[model samples]
Target chain A: MGKVAREVVEKAGINVDELVKKLVRAAGAEFTTYYYYTILRANAIGFDGEGIKEIIEDMRIEDRNHFEALVPRIYELGGELHRDIKDFCKDAACPDAYLPSNPRDVKALLQVLIEAERCAIRVYADICALTAGKDPRTYELSAAIMNEEIEHEAWCSEFLGEGPSGHFRRGAPGESPYVSRFLVVPKPGV
Target chain B: MERRWVTIADSSELAADGVKGFSVGDKRIVVVRYRGRYYAFDAACPHMAGPLDEGTIVEGRLECPWHHYLYDLESGENYYPKNVYPDDLKHTVAPLRKYPIRETEGKLWVALEDAKA
Candidate 1:
């Protein structure tokens, strides 16, 4: 726990403990979504259009990146992940992105992806809003994360044929254009 | 026996199939408006304490947002895995924890189990 770091936020009239709970939930959602997206991506092989797998994979790794980026901040605020993994996932801010009952249907799969991204957008947006003036570090980090989530939603929605994403592909999968600067240790796996 | 009737949010606030969760003393619970009627249940899923309020409504059953486990609203029965996995004997899934709720004058009240006894 960053004793002085948390004190400043508390003195700013922000409920640091409540904010920490929200942060942990948001991080849990990202990690659990990463898990669910793996299953969704595997089924994307021949189901949807050409870039289906790529879109899912990109969001999957970036979601993990979001988790990684949020951890240091969580500890900084004096919050820690639950000792049990089950508790952590159960308390995630966003719902788990479970594969649809019928995974073969491409449309259902796309809907799952779209909804998950949309939920992520809400999560980060809430964090950004909460910390906007009181905590510069958390606010900036959440805003950066939300920027990526917005694009992810657009990509998934576009894939679902809802509309054009207005985005070409990222330089590579999970490039995390807005968030990579926060990841001191690069490469989600490395 | 004593019962604690706690007033929940106004009826107009919750839409159809909508869920709202709150703390009644030390216990967390969710008040759901389903099919134009109000029903209350323990906010946490029996399996993993998944926020049932975050769950999706499906055919009178609520799907736990964490694992997609389904629970019947009124009966508080495990719906999904029970429907899929037959009595092969490893029935770890439990029924939804339920609370009794009543409505009067545009407001809803829930009877919580862990009230001061």
Candidate 2:
């Protein structure tokens, strides 16, 4: 097993540790969507396009639902829901500042959401695989979370009016160049 | 058996500003030249195996087109900033793996050894 998984098994008691990790991973996934929607809502103001505005608003609520579902699991695992925005930001794989330049654009907003959903799918899959048969409760929780993420991905794809694979092409028009410019280089021969 | 050096492409095809993809012996590789030096690595992103050829080159790193995970060309390290967790979770660290690279005669090469072998 990897060092992180082994350390987690040792420090927090196998059952509780797996539960905590799974919950944190689920919450972390929702946090990314929540952060994106919050920015999108702020950018939607003054835009007279009601359809675009409504879509953004609806997604904001869906993300909130995901966050709410994670609260009880966090408590069950003897861990506090990460309430502080700074803490959430600290744990994010991609920083909030790297958000889209034009959040009012539905295309750009959906792009970010799709990316978040993909990451969530991977994280939840890992959690479910690790906890399967070991902690049935966490296994079930991860399975449910994965289903929700799949729905989110589908919704984003539908909103873009393109097949799921279409978003991988050139970035949205007028989107921030910084998002593409910011590269994460790994260490040598890791 | 016959010795072959398929002309993948000219080195100039990959300028300092961008990255290019090539195939050799069924192995896909990405050639990135940064600061006038060429470096090569697996053409897929480590995060989700996204195509690195479709990604952009920034500074000395190749940014994954999928989730924007960056990999340094020379060292193959993730250039993205590290996540700083709370003191309670400081012990958790997730780092990406890197691959070997070589540049000779203006052509880049990467090792393609099967782990099981």
Candidate 3:
């Protein structure tokens, strides 16, 4: 708990406490999405000959990265993730990305993926709006997370032939191009 | 404990469409005017607590602005999922509890309990 770090945000007229609650909710959404995406990834295999599999894996891992990046900031703002995992998950800011009852339907899977990304985009957009021009650190972090979420949406939307994502697949899986800077602790394979 | 009537919003703050949010204590309440009458309800939407204070009264159903979840304006009974899915899908949502509200002299007041739900 850095006293001055929290002090500065409050002094800027931001409701430091409410901001912390939003961060915790955002983190919970990321953590649960990581868990759910793993199941979706398994279902993705051999679907359209595995092109979707690789993308699902990237999104799954990046969602985990988002969870890792959000925690330190929550603590910096004097907030903590709920002590009970169930409590944390129940309060997640987005609906659970449940595998469709009909997982074999590729469009059903894509719809789930796209909607989850859309919800994440809205969640971070609100955070960014709240912190913009006030809390620089939180603002940067949320803006970065929002970038990745938007790309995730584009990728899923393009896969569904909604349109071109205007982007290509990751150079390496789950590179998290926008959010990587905030991920200070490197994972083993990175 | 008896609840006291608290002034929530000026009648003029509402738009012609009659959708607006006002803060009363720590709670965010949405005040809507439907059919030449006003109504108030807590704004937390199902699942994400979103669609907060940004909903529309469409044909007497309050529609969640983001996901389009619908509820009856007066009774607060959810009218979605149950309408869209199969008869056996058995989708149910927690009813949105309505706050007891009154309009007088161009002002809206709600009787919120000391410890509200």
TM-scores of the candidates are 0.67, 0.48, 0.75
* DockQ head-to-head 1 vs 2, winner: 1
Tens digit per residue, CA lDDT, model 3, A1-190: 8799999999999999888878888898899989999988888756472768888888999999999999999998889999999989977766567777766767777877887887788778878988999999999999999999999999999999989999978988889998899997886776
Candidate 1's displacement at residue B12, Å, is: 13
Candidate 1 chain B has its poorest 10 consecutive residues by lDDT at B81-90
What are the Cα lDDT values of the candidates?
A: 0.80, 0.55, 0.80
Residue pairs with clashing backbones, model 3: none
Query: Interface RMSD of the predictions, in order shown?
Result: 7.4, 9.8, 5.2
Candidate No. with top DockQ: 3
Regions of model 1 farther than 4 Å from truth = A47-50, A187-190, B1-117
Q: What's the TM-score, to 2 decimals, of chain B in model 3?
A: 0.84
Superposed by TM-score, candidate 1 places the C-alpha of residue A21 at a distance from the truth, in angstroms, of: 1.1
| CA deviation > 4 Å runs, candidate 3 | B1-11, B15-19, B22-29, B32-40, B44-51, B54-92, B95-117
Residue-level error in angstroms, candidate 2, position A177: 37
Question: Which residue window of length 10 is worst by lDDT in model 2 chain A?
Answer: A174-183
| List of clashing residue pairs for candidate 1 | none
